[model samples]
Target: MNLTLASGAPRPSQTFRTVFPVLALCWLAVFFDGMDVNIYGAVMPHMLDDSGLGLTPASAGTIGSWTTFGMLIGALTAGNLTDWLGRRLMLVASVTLFSVGSAVCAVAGGVALFGFGRFVSGLGLGGLMPLCLAMVMEFAPPRRAALTTGLLMTSYHFGGMAATGLGLTLAQAAGWRWVFWAGVLPAVIAVPLLLKLLPESPGVLLARGEREKADAV
Candidate 1:
């Protein structure tokens, strides 16, 4: 069956063909977002056990707070940036930032460095959800928007599960640093696909008054 937009203009079949690919890309990005978000908790015990890092309860709490603070800053800024950067590019940058942050943590020699790494990761994490939801809304069928959203959210839990499995299997044998190293994998896997395949949201282009570009999208 053909799906029609409320606008009753373009044929929905053509639209949905584009929509599904975009949805898949967004879902994968969000999946990594979830994985990175929960990976810290999954590996926290091991982090505390590592003597070189010096993770006391007070300092751990402080490190976690720095992550949250960075998130607050990122979240506040990302929406504004979206107008200029476009959602797809912004998502790419967010992923790259967090992946680099995780790499920093993986190699960090001191508390201050690790804390800064987590803060950087948090900033990237904060921007991801809002950008993803907005893009998903733009791509999903009107009647199925809420249902599609619910479906998209399940990827996050699946991501958390993958992080847990990685922690269980790899943390003790390879070390906590390996887990953070694993965090870097998302950039390797996701960024290339995003840049090569995922089309920018037409809504964003139209909003910027680039009607020709919007139609091309």
Candidate 2:
């Protein structure tokens, strides 16, 4: 199917049709990303209360700083790496890395291990935001790019809400570990959908010298 704009150009309606699936996938992924990123914060109070974890307020602050530091490195590296690797691969890698980190957190026996897990997860979390934003912007109608970006960002808050809800309910009952387990669920749900539905950026395909694939999009 084709859609016509005011300029009388014959554009593919299906061009934007791909937008719904991709956007939904990106939204869910970002939502999970947000929940994972905030899970530590959401459960910090309980973590500190657990004497076995040996977490103090000062140590907690230090760990938070370390996670942020790791995120900075992740974002910078992923920006350059995305150019070399395709978006879909990077997205999958990011989701996988973060999910592993969440599992590590769920099973962590010491503060050191938990900190390390958060730092590792930070890398994936930091990398995902820009990539999703870029994809949404590129796929959206030119005039609606700003709106699309805004809409994409709302997923983060939704994820945060989910995290908050989980922290309130599960953290009190099953404990903080369960909250971390919840963080890992996104990887299970999102990675497969991304692999199946999210198409490679046409521009990226063209740049990689896959002209036919680019044009086929």
* The best candidate in terms of lDDT: 1
Top TM-score prediction, candidate number:
2
Give me candidate 1's TM-score against the actual structure.
0.93
Angstrom error of the Cα, residue 45, model 2: value is: 1.0
Q: How much is 26 displaced in model 1, in angstroms? A: 0.9
lDDT of each: 0.88, 0.86
Which ranges of candidate 1 are over 4 A from the true structure?
1-12
What does candidate 1's lDDT look like per residue over 1-217, in tens digits? Answer: 1345678666767767866877788889889988988888888889899999999888988988898898899899999999999998999999998999999999999899999999999999999888888888887877678887887888899999989988888998899999999999879999999999977878788898989988776
Give RMSD (Å) of candidate 1 vs. truth.
2.4
